[model samples]
Target: MKKSISNSLLLLSGIIILASCHSKKQLVKRQADSSAVRTDNAASAVKNKINAIKSKQVSFTTFSGKAKTKLNVNGNSNDVTMNIRIQKNQKIWVSITAVIGIEVARALITPDSILVINKLQSVYIKKPFSYIYTYASRQVNYKTVESLLVGNAIPELLNENGKLEPSNGNVVIDGQLQDLLYKLIIGPDLKVTSTDLSNQSAGQSLHIDNSAFVQADGRVIPSEIAFSSTVKNKTIQADLKYSKTEFDQPLDFPFSIPSRFSQVN
Candidate 1:
């Protein structure tokens, strides 16, 4: 039972890539017409649209959500309910519950450390943040994780020099950051519809698709998110459907390993 709970927690952490941070920028008006004719200065228009999308990024000191998550890996599938909370640039807390609402695992992630307690096994794992790079790619970090969870442009991708192009009736922003190539698709509503990040030399790729945007606290946020990644030919996928979410709400992050529990590594 402990092994099962550990595996489930590990899988959830890998799939969620949970992290948090805050940034403020200007919001650009949403482009309502997808069929608008492109002018000779289409490049300028596209750049403006990308900028607007970045500007409207949601900023909050804290966030909390209850989600139903489905994870599939190498042909096996599992469903779990996650209670997640984020304190920008500080920590991410998650509780995983299994059958009959029994709490099985809890994780607390910070900028410098990762900690998970397997209540079923009475064991815990404590490692540095760098431990996550082993599961995904070297490009996976706190900022990227945070951005991915909230459906915002990754900081590294945003900083890179990029080109704007048209693809399948939407605007595609392409760029290379370090060894990774990224293509971001932006819709007429100025929201990101999808993002693809690939490192050809490493044969690793991460793709995220978001939809079902609804207004929350005066900000538009994606309620449905799909994440998929292929690392060394092993594929992992997760879909998150947030049922309740809010920002700036007072929340408690309680974590204490029982004295009887033993540490693993």
Candidate 2:
């Protein structure tokens, strides 16, 4: 009778151990599955956010604005007024005036070419669109310039090379697009707060801050923007505050260099 009782107790203990082990395995599997689901949900949310931002971009036939501009070049600072006009996807015209309302410079930029009139020097510069590369980085294009002026994300960066990361409650999209590493910080309101681009091999970088939204033509637009670019150890920074903004308005981009002005390469 004693031996039978001992045998029964050992059998019961083994059964209990087996059941506990099975329970533990099931619990671990459930935990892993839950984590994976959470990750998938996060990825989906990020994709949705990116799509929403793209859809909400401002669309218009024309744009005109007056900006209070402050420029800094190699420690020299000047305040000027910039009257800007844009025929969407066609041309951008700018007239820069001194503090006393004297026009000092004007520029006309098209998809293929760039022309500038320097009133102070009585010189005009005409070159292909690639001329911009002399001052800015090689990654800059016509679309890039248009997007920067309007606080829109770079179209090239929204591709497979970009990754959206959430850090410290900020949404940052960063990746290598071409030879440049770019990061675009987005605000909670889904607008771009800032953009940063750098090329390690070339020692070049561009930084832009976009802020102060104003509504025009049923669209929100950035009214304040700051740009800083460094190329080959030279740095240029400009801060623009838009006091007047209009969209879809009939605008004129008249740019004609004077015959007396000398050509600059």
Tell me, by TM-score, which candidate is best: 1
lDDT, residue 221, model 2: 63
For candidate 1, write residues 1-265 as lDDT tens digits: 4465467577546544442212222223445455343423366665556556677677888888877777666656767677888888888899977756888899998888888998888889988888876565677677666677677777666542577766666767788877878888877665778889888887778888877776666777777788787777567777777767788888899999889999987
lDDT of each residue in 24-141, candidate 2, tens digit only: 1111101111111111236676666677667756777887777777766555667777777878889888777788888877777788887767777787777888765655556767
lDDT of 2: 0.64
TM-score of each: 0.84, 0.81
Off by over 4 Å in 1: 1-5, 15-47
lDDT of 2 at 263: 91
